[model samples]
Target: MSESIEMTAKAPVRSAPAPRRTTPAPRRRSTRRGPLHPATWAPTTVLVLILGLIWSAIAAEHPYILPELSEVGLALVDRPEVFLTNAWTTLSIALAGVACGAGTAFVLALVMSEVPVVRRALMPLAVVLNVTPVVALAPGLVLAFGFGMTPKVVVTAIITFFPVLINVTTGLRAVPPSVLHVFETLHASRTEVLWRARILYGLPYTFAALRVVMPLSIVGAVVAEFVAAGSTGGLGTMIRNAASTARLESVYAAIACLAAMGVLMLALVTAVERRVLFWHESQRRAST
Candidate 1:
């Protein structure tokens, strides 16, 4: 019995059966394409194809009504200086208007977001202004501000204002209840909550509005240029003068420039949004 006990004691003790190593269920790889992925360019490729088809159709069927794409391109090549100068004029007006409108809207949105009563009082007035036909107001604005860039900038600002206001206000209030509770629990001040939480959350919405307003601002500037009696330069003026003279190629060239401008602005805003919101789920998924 002593020998048996000694033998048993001599036998090496086993560790509690080694815990099974869990290979974490292999994380599922996302099938979604990143921005640079070829698949993400497919829509743009399709759009180019569609545009090519339309160009072909227009060239074949309505040769007189609309000049060939080549003619439009030639117009641009022929008078690059003219187009560039007018484009600069229009762009300046748009930039000024966007700055004014977006700045004012941001300040107002901050106030309205913080004070519900202000939002309630100002929202209807904003809606009325939005609904009032901007085209009708163009002449009056020109008359008031004169035939200079002031009227055009004002028109652009008015057009760009409401979208930013509405979007920013919505974004400011979109904080998750639980997240807000945590902020409150931490005794964060109003400014701290706004800057750290609300502003960050609202960035996506603000960018979305910017994408829209940037293009819309150009349209507003063009509209103002149309009505401003003494307006001397701009794509709108170019288009009007060209159309009056049946210069379809020039008209289309100006239009193409406008389209390019809008696309460029949208691309800029998108790039900024991606950079700013890299941490956002939407952008993260897009990156994936």
Candidate 2:
């Protein structure tokens, strides 16, 4: 009887760790995918391959004008500190100028958008500035702002502002009339319309402008530095110094650093766009 009771006690407990219920881990979005996903690394690989071939061709055909890729690589590897410091300086000028310029453009866009007459009045001024050759104006800017960071910053800003202004103005006007009408029916204020509808509508266009303007600002600052050449401590200065003594390797290295800086900024902008515009159709499509 005791043995029978023991067997009954040991038999079939109802609980068995509740079948180990677990939520599956969420999958990560991998930037690096297999060749099956050609969109991942195919273009980048192709670009690098093409660049390598062109570089080889240049090295073989015109050795004096363009140093071998290996030489540029050696120079870059040897002078890490110089490249880093100069790259930082150039990047700073680009960032500061773009931020300020984009802000000014947004304000001007708002003003022009709300008041149609301001477009006629303000556009001529923008056109004049846009048409003025920045290289020709660099010396004057240096004279006015002194041979320092101010001139470079101003030059960068001037180069970036107009394109941004045009983009923002277009974006603000691109809001659907139906959406505006809905807000109107609800008796929304001008500020509400401006912020909720127009600004949101303009974000993609503004980002597109940003992608172009940021690189142009970098170019602008570099050119300004060239015109105001000295110990300014930027990629432009490095280029000027290298070119003076015909150190083609160093010139190529500095140029490569400049390219890297532009690429980094562009990547950052793209990342921000992905985060901010995740709900947009483009982002949705890209993610899938």
Candidate 3:
């Protein structure tokens, strides 16, 4: 018994088997799609269908009211130079007017945001301008600035000014009270507060206003072209001349060009807004 006990004590202890670690099964990736998935192409598909319908109507009815798409296409293709030159002219006027108007409105908005007195004083005049007919003002502008590009640009600027002023002012004042308090605690100067906080916060609003005013600038330019004496070139001028001559194809062609320009301008503003406001919630949602 003593020998057996000694052997048992000398024997090495065997350990229980270790547990095998089982990793969780890999989770399946979601098959869901974002907002910009292939389904978003529905609008473009609809547009194509509408064009097809129009083509069919032209083929069946032979309508004098609507020129054949091919004829309009040929009008554009044949005199590309004429259309290109006018398009450039109108585009330049719109660009210049937008720059001038938006800049001026931004400055005024800054002032109005800082001073209640200035805002109260200017608000009435702005309302007056907004209410006044742009067509009525065109002749006076022509009389004052002459029939050069100046009048057209001024008209566009006038058209774009109020929208920017309103939007930017609202945006500047839209900053949260907590943010302003934080700035105050930092002993930030007015200029610093404006540059650092207000301007940055106002960007989205400014772009929203821009999206509106950009297309509006085109209309303003065209209206000026229609009425301003001695107006020689632009899509508006082409349209007027073509219409007077009963050149239905040319008229439609110019109209198409104007439509294209408006779309391009809107797209441009949207693209810029996306780039600048990439961190904004709207852009975040769009990306996802």
Candidate 4:
């Protein structure tokens, strides 16, 4: 009986299943896509290509109409003195005008922020000034300021002011609720809140508005020169000379110079923006 019981146990043990082997689970990979930002060179690249094609076509037919890029380049190189002097004159006026306009706008925007009643009073007045038409008003400005930089500067300031005012006001109003709440919790005074919070927050917008106004101010200065004509040797005067003499090429060259000036001024403003507001979203976008 003992031997039979032992045999039964051994037989059950022998029939038991073999040890099961377990396999490790497969690892999963993350399939997230990276940032899909556009490149800065894309637009400039396309513009250059289009300009080159147009230039080439012009060069092929009516070569005079399509002055050789090389010719224009040579003209730039050969008589840089004329271009540089005229550019300097125009730029000085433009900078002066920008200063006046920006200062006035800053003060006005601050005042408006503090006194909404003043804003309501001044807004319609500003609109009347803005839509009064530059060509018609420019002659009157020249008549008042007497055919010198004074008139040009005044015209430029007039044309340039509204943009700065609008932008600065908008910026002053952009103070975030969270920031305001923080100020309140700290028991900050109204002046402190404005100087520390509102102005700081509005800086980017102020710069953006200046970027727009700077170019327009240039146009304004040039227009004033047109009205004050025959006494000045500005780019505007150069245009008149070319027009009177029927030198279309020279006129085109002057126009090109004006374009270059606008580009340079705008570029400088953009650089300032990048430096001053490196943390701002706009700067990040421009960089990308």
Candidate 5:
């Protein structure tokens, strides 16, 4: 009986299966990172300093051609009202032109992106317009529109439209096939596809173009005003008058005003980009 009990216990112990060993799971990485420091601004700071130094050197060497920064400052202070009024006029015209041009470009780009035939027809026209020199057309526009702000605005629009059109069209077509397949399976309508997929997908590129287009539009407006030669109320006209009268410092002041306007426009576009394309990689990195 003792041998039988012992044998039974041994048999049961040997027959039991071993416990399965479990491997531990790997650690997951955290996606969080810290904000950008002041060092992030280093490149822009260096560029500004370099530009200032070069400008100072040029002003010191050629007092007649390039007025001293201090002289330009004095000119700005001496006639603040004139500067403000002229600058306001220039801003008004430039902003108007940009708004109109951007709107038109957006509609045309949407159409072209969806319809391959339209894209084939319009893309060549866009390229030709882009390659056409603004200087050559500005004079003709002024002659046709009779030296008014109308002509200047049209000239600015013509100069700025191509970039917006090209960039937005490129972006609209850039939606991935995988994403489009999802939409297709869901049976989304054409308007839904455009609004939910294409336009939203293209938002970053549109804003990117805006960043370039806004300042260039301002420059175009000012240049057109200079060519038109009848207006005394904008920065371009002020610069022309100052140059003709040999007031180099005043001309420099007008140039400074133009630069300030360009900077403001660029800043505004950047702000809008952050707000509108906040989901984009560029903005995401910037925010982080």
Candidate 6:
């Protein structure tokens, strides 16, 4: 017994390791992308069904005021070329105008972001311009620029400019105070901060504005067409002409094209935003 005790005492002793202060692995949040995926077109499918039901009810009740979607479909099928031609004209001018306006707005927004004096002077002016009815402004633009694409382009620019400028400016100012202070401490140049931080952070905001402004550009173009007596072009002209002749089906058909155009524009912007902002946290959350 003595020998056994001595041997045991001589043996190495082991105590249980203090419970490891392990951080539990972070809970993996499950993310699924089946029906809810933005690419799934699920919402659009449901909307189309709802629209179909509404159309059927309207067609059965008052075909005169709101003609059957079938009637509009027939009109579109019968003279697709006419509709396409007018649509192209309107789209062309709207595209050009939006491009010019967006470029100008970007430059102006950047300047406003950098210069308090400019921001103070111009923001209210921009708001005033934005609030002025395009209906009223279109006529004068037409008179000034003559009844050409120029007036319509100007009108579209007027419509698209403010939203982009507002969003970009708001985004520029959204930088964290700490981040700005750090940059100042580091003596970063204005141009450096503008390009690397402000512009990068402002992308999401700018894109949101793009989505809102696109349809507005269409409305502006149409309004300009209404006032552009000598335009002799565009779906708006066709619409006004058809309405005057009491061709209600044609009017509906033309309006459908406008709706389609708006949908396409929104889709284009959404796709671009998704691609460009894939690394952003909000965008990543949406994707997952």
lDDT of 6 at 36: 70
TM-score per candidate, in order?
0.88, 0.84, 0.86, 0.79, 0.84, 0.87
| Model 6 Cα lDDT, one tens digit per residue, 1-288 | 999999999999898889879788998776756667775777889999999999879878987778877888999999999999999998888888888888789899999998999999999999999899877877777778887799889988988998899898998888888888888999999998988789888998999999998877788788778877697988899999999988989998999999899889998998899999998887888866
- Badly placed stretches (over 4 Å) of model 3 are 1-37, 55-62
Residue 238 of model 4, lDDT score: 79
Query: Between the candidate structures 5 and 6, which one is better when assessed by TM-score?
Result: 6
Instruction: Go through the candidates in order and give each one's C-alpha lDDT.
Output: 0.92, 0.88, 0.90, 0.82, 0.86, 0.87
Clashes within 3 Å, all models in order: 0, 0, 0, 0, 0, 0
Model 5 misplaced regions, further than 4 Å: 1-37, 40-54
- List, residue by residue over 1-288, the lDDT tens digit for candidate 2: 999999999998776565677899999776644457778678889999999999889898999978899999999899899899998998888888888888899899999999999988999999899999888888888788887798888888889999999999999999999999999999999999999999999999999998898778789879878886344588998899889999999998998888888888888888899899988887877765
Better of 2 and 4 by TM-score: 2
Look at candidate 3 and give me any clashing residue pairs.
none
Task: Write down the worst ten-residue block by lDDT for model 2.
Answer: 28-37
Between the candidate structures 2 and 3, which one is better when assessed by TM-score? 3
Worst 10 residues of 4 by lDDT: 31-40
Residue 210's lDDT in candidate 4: 80
lDDT of 1 by residue, 113-186 (tens): 99999999999999999999888988888778887889889989999999999999999999999989999999
lDDT per residue (tens digit) for residues 1-288 in model 5 = 999999988884456777899998987664544336455677778999999889899989988878888888999999999999999998888888887888899999999988999999989988998898877887777678886688888878887899899899988998999989999999998889899999888988888899999999879888878776577678888888888999999988988888988999899888877787777888777754
- Residue-wise C-alpha lDDT for candidate 3, range 1-288, written one tens digit per residue: 999999999999999999999999999775556557676777788998899788769745865677778888999999999999999999999899988988899999999999999999998999899889888988998899887999999888989999999999999998999999999999999999999999989998999999999998899889878988899999999999988988989998998899899999999999999999999887787665
Task: Return the candidate ranking by TM-score, descending.
Answer: 1, 6, 3, 2, 5, 4
| Model 5: worst 10 consecutive residues (lDDT sum) | 30-39
Name the regions of candidate 1 deviating beyond 4 angstroms. Answer: 1-38
